[model samples]
Target: MSLPRNLCHGTLDEIVERGGLTEVTGADGGPYLELVSSAFPGGQAPVGEARVFTGDSIAKVVYVGLAVPQIGLDSHMVFAFCPADVAVPHFTLDSVQGQGTYAFHLDLIPRADLGTHLPYLDWAHTPLDATYEEVESRPGLMKTAIGPRQFAMMSPWMLVHRAEDEAFRGISDAVKAYLDHWFSLVEAGVPAEVVADVADTDLAARDARNRTNVFSPDVDKVWAQVERLIGHEQTEAVRGLLLDNCPPEVSA
Candidate 1:
């Protein structure tokens, strides 16, 4: 896919002067079509890392990429969501084509150690075919032919081709609206019986179990002791109190 027309780059100095990487804003106060990075973490090359081009552009994330700009000698660059670990690539015009489109993948800390280009790699990925093991840090750490993996530790960071509106910012408002409606229904005295639902699923139990999957056996036992100290019924009662504090207007 092609790049956004508004996409533009400034020198490291210019970005530093302008308050670093940020979502572009128009006079009307709109959201970002894409965010920009003027500085990388730990000071790695800001224009040449492959991980920057391969990761997701939205959500809680960190990535690396090869950044290209006009006016300088062409070179392999590194850019990231965090401070750089090395110098960003200064490339010739001939080598700048489609450099921004490359994606970030898992890697290591770069040779440099400060300013905007710190190398950050993904934790690990679950395998296509694996058996899940019950552990403490997670409730189900899957074992693969290659190694141990956890779905909780995995995030697919593929980008959408240009023109995929939802991938950028299309459906966020709609999802929020739908959630508001669900909360409203529950609060409106609409009996879940009329809604044809049985007992609310034990989402907390499931979540607690998942949290244990990554822990060592000793740590898991320790966490269990801590939970017992808190008492299960009291925890549920606290959750109920939280639910009761909901706003009357939205969840009505």
Candidate 2:
């Protein structure tokens, strides 16, 4: 079977184009895509990294790709970050393909407590719920493989499933629908005055929550491998960009 390169890059292209995001150079003087040669065990192949875009809406993206020969370990992660002021959900798509099995975890993660934020949930949650149900009703799709801790960061509409041939088209359609809905949220974002009214403590807590999600143990394991291959400085640079370390004061 041919490699499903489109599963990663094609989706990213659609996101950038639809969102009208512009490409920007990352702090490392590269276009967000760093070549990490030591990412694979035994230094077999260089991982292709691409930031894709960092737009005026304060949305940032990172794409990591690895294809190891013979062992058939091909994986990709596309993480999209929105600023705290936007109060919109951040997007994450993680997929691993190996030995004729495909695993997927895709969601628009909420930055705050979904249960308490009725307005936010009202604005975004319903569509996600409908989509999740539609996908769940399909045959041969396994439930999402996430634990309770991870579940806390996700909205009620997250899609986590495993499948063989059936997964490819189903996941592609879900990605398109979810992203279109998210782009609408970006388009109809809160007014500046409303954003200004948001309490500092609220913003700080949101930042903390986002950081916790990004710096999870699973993420750390991946970083450790990258650090071992690329060294501390480069690894930290990638982490900072992905997590967006800019202080709220500075951002404002």
Using lDDT as the measure, the top candidate is 2
Task: Encode model 1's per-residue lDDT on 1-252: one tens digit a residue.
Answer: 112211112222222223233332322344211123233344323332111111112101111122335323122222222111111111100112233332111111111212222221111112201211111123222122212243232222211122222222332232233223322332243343422221232333432342234233233243342223334443233222212112112121
Worst 10 residues of 1 by lDDT: 86-95
List model 2 lDDT by residue over 1-252, tens digit each. Answer: 333456767777777776777666556556554556655457635555656566655467766665655456567777777775567777778777767777777788876566665555667667777778888888878785557766666666888788667665567888778888887877788645434434333854676666667666464466775566556776666666666634211111
Model 2 Cα RMSD, 1 decimal: 4.8
Whole-model Cα lDDT of every candidate shown, in order:
0.23, 0.66
Badly placed stretches (over 4 Å) of model 2 are 1-4, 25-31, 38-44, 191-201, 218-236, 245-252
